[model samples]
Target: MTRSWRPWIAGATGLALVAGAGVIWSVRGSDPGSGCERTTITIAASLDHAPVLQTIADGWLRTDPRVDGRCPDIRIVAARSADVAANLGDARAAGGSAAPSISPTAPLSPSESAAAAASAVSDASRRPTVWAPDSRAWAGLAGTRPEAASLLAPGAPSVALTPIVMATTPDRAGALEGRITWPDVLRQIATGRAPLVLGTTDPTASTAALLTLMSLADTDGDGKPTAAEIAGPLALERTARVYAGSVDVLAAQMSPGDSAGSAPGARVSLFPATEQEVLRLSASGDAPPLVPLYPAEGVAPADHPYYVLNAGWVSARQRAVATAFLDVVLGTAGRTAYAAAGFRDRDGTLAGLTSASGALDAAYRGRPLPGTAALTEVLVRWRALRRPANVIAAVDTSGSMTEKVPGLPISKLAAFRQAGIQAVRLFNDRSRLGLWEFSSDLSGSRDYRVVVPVRTMADQVGPVSQRETIIAATNRLRPHSATGLYDTIDAAYRAVQGIWRADQQNILVVMTDGRNEDEDGFGLDELLGRLRAAKNPAKPVTVLAIAYGSGADVQALQRVTEVTGGRTFVSRDPADIGAVLLSAMVNR
Candidate 1:
């Protein structure tokens, strides 16, 4: 484990992982070559700070820094902060597995022993010798995952900082600039009171998203979002179109000119992103400048912390190099590099251009992140809420779907099928779901055909499972017939009502691009009549209909949903289907 290395450079709210071996950097700088083995130290950084870290690494290389009598080879790569912590956890798990077996195990020969040693080194090589996540929150988050336990070394010093914020154009910022509470916006959208559309990256992978959810759901001052208040924000997932997976992409999509800050795939009015991103977007680029909508409470500043891993694989010399490199990062060189990259110094002061950066114009106030336990609670509650749905998804397979959407490259049917599969994937095994494809005479005299039967998602159907069958069926579906919207809704609604599990949330979802064209089947009036007549108070089936493309009859879809006390969402652009499908399928 004593691989020689060059001088080291540079890790979070703090998921306070169990204390590991502490690193103390007090060594003097040595010459370029130490006549020792050449070692490479990799720093896996969050997207925000990866570039800046590379700058620091480049400077360190010039100095030909040496630590513990070994020259260091520093490498920096962009990676999710949570992933690095998880990898460390996995590495420790691997280390445990690599340990020699006891009892009946036989001694390995020369060739066999060399092969085993090579496997061990290969695993160690893949893991970053140094982990530099964007925020302290990641450390706190890592504490929640059992496998990531003790993966981060103790005393990870905060080097640079940036707050999590809602980024929007200057004009829009005026309306949303205070202690911006997100739940209120979500509730307004859910109840049909507001026309505002906001976008966010996936919370599971993005720290900016996770911290925003933590803030949005934390209605009470308890520092954790309770189930009671979290429902409002939970709808953010359903209306299905609000998710924008990246800051750069969302910023580009949301221009000031697009009068309607509509579908996330198109443009959103507001988006949650890192402060540096907002600054970078506004400072330059064809995209409009963005301002911050600071939460009424406070912001979770991404505190770039430096962690010297205490894992068994990180030898004394590697730890020494990591520790020394951390010193370089906190010094004048590191601080200067980070500031040049639009990050704040360890102190509250900014590096000029504060107004454009979307901070409170030289007024930076950041609150301490919650404890690991509190952070873990928020995640657990989110996982508990964003799951287990009972749905009857009906997709329109009309010939009209064969035509490509105006603004998108893919055909309407391709986008529709993708959206359906994504919505079903969001559901868990505990839920019961069914998939149906509809067109003119899709099945002998019937306008709809059951691709998958309603049952527990995990249930097996002959050779195919419920989840697998729906995905496969939707992919195999083609478009060559006419729309039969009315009858399909009636049948799916009745199907949901028939099984009617009191324990689960039951709802029927309809995805269509056009109005009813089947003269042989029931009309819109008859369909609504059947739904109204068959509606039982005990077994309620809410209809969530998604009208894809411009051809959809909004009035007709609206009337159909109103009968079942459900809602209709219109996706004028086929590209918006995935973003719109989740919010449509998931019932509150």
Candidate 2:
């Protein structure tokens, strides 16, 4: 949209207001009255490069006001690449819903028709005119749909490049330097013999995490993988080992001291992150400087792409302005600023700050990203193939849960039972699962009663397998007595810890409603103390608590999860318990 604008001079000094130390020189000579109007272009870009892009945009505005009647007023918004991709996908899905059905009996006037067309343009323009995502995978994802495809301009050029890497202390990097490949990292973790503690960001959230999975899946020399390769048992096992919850969790565990190397006490010894992230962390001095180790195989670099949208909201003039904005980003000054912020040039070559930026070696090259279909396949495969969980499910049989769910005829307990069965199906034969129904007086003096003991699903009974037994027992669960939330949580945590295996993602999945009602059991203070005392760094067991219905004590649940490394999932509507349980079951 074009807007009447005043002359706004953003000097190079504005660049310093952002992250990283970059010397940005502004382009001058344009007066405020030089251009009649300006087209405001909003670019939703990855968090890493948004500030630098703004700097470039500022320079472009000063250097050249209007290329063809429309001056550009670029506004850069920070967003995750995956989020932007998801938004585009959602917009495409909703494209047709906004159209009003016109009856033939009443034709609109010309003015009304113009208003309707403008309204349509406004709806389309609600989305960003330009999207500069971290990797080309997102662009590949957006191209699959007609609505999203219409928004994309051809030939999106890479503005900057940063390879995903495994960063650790110098000692760990030295140890694994020449010997390490993508599979080896997973193998080391599976064997519980990794030279350093391995971790990665959440695949669902971070493109780097998914790429890390892709690298492991790329068994052959070629970056592309066949369905057969991804479905193989070994590949799945490796991917499971590589995922260590989320990046925030990993970052929290990192040692803040410079002297802290790959010691036993150090939370994370090795993590997969962008090179720029590693530099940022090191620069902050809150953590020790990490030494990046490139894998023996190829790497997937986040080649930030500038895509000028071809949507109805973006006029021909706006398109030209976006192209001009891209040119400025690819120009010499833009390259220098990116180099200062620890990014490689568009050609995948190292920037001027070789030593300061910990530049990648010349041999390191960018690998081709998987196609849209294959990438989608790999992500779906990852969910199923992830580390088999050792879960002790505490299904609350509290009296409150007996009440019927809103709008649905089924009771809360009934919904949970069905959901339990559905969630159990997500785990495979490799997983160890168990069921426990908790409420006061259910198991004679205890607040919790173990219905099905935790055991490997592969174990054989007299006739049926252990997995079938758990499913059958879960379906038979019934609501009974008062909620013994705190005591049951303590018992489950202790029980899961007893059988904790370093390789497995040991967890206590507590599905409950209402606060601790066991006056006879230990109070919240005592339970919290006990849980804190039960903490074990080497063998971690996260508590995934699901607070079901309005009566569910969310505050109490959060307190319980704080002691453990797990999180609480709330489903206020009992109708959504099934979906919520399914999501909570996934490791991500």
How close is each model in CA RMSD to the real structure?
A: 17.9, 15.9
List candidate 2 stretches off by more than 4 Å: 1-35, 89-95, 98-126, 223-249, 256-266, 357-359, 386-588
Candidate of highest lDDT: 2
All candidates' lDDT scores? 0.66, 0.68
lDDT of 2 at 360: 59
* Weakest lDDT window of 10 consecutive positions for candidate 1: 100-109
Among all windows of 10 consecutive residues in model 2, the one with the lowest summed lDDT is 9-18
TM-scores of the candidates in the order shown: 0.56, 0.57
Candidate 2 local distance difference test against the native: 0.68
lDDT of 1 by residue, 44-131 (tens): 6677787777677667766665576566766554655644443334334444443211110111123422322222234354355677
Cα shift from native, residue 11, model 1 (Å): 18
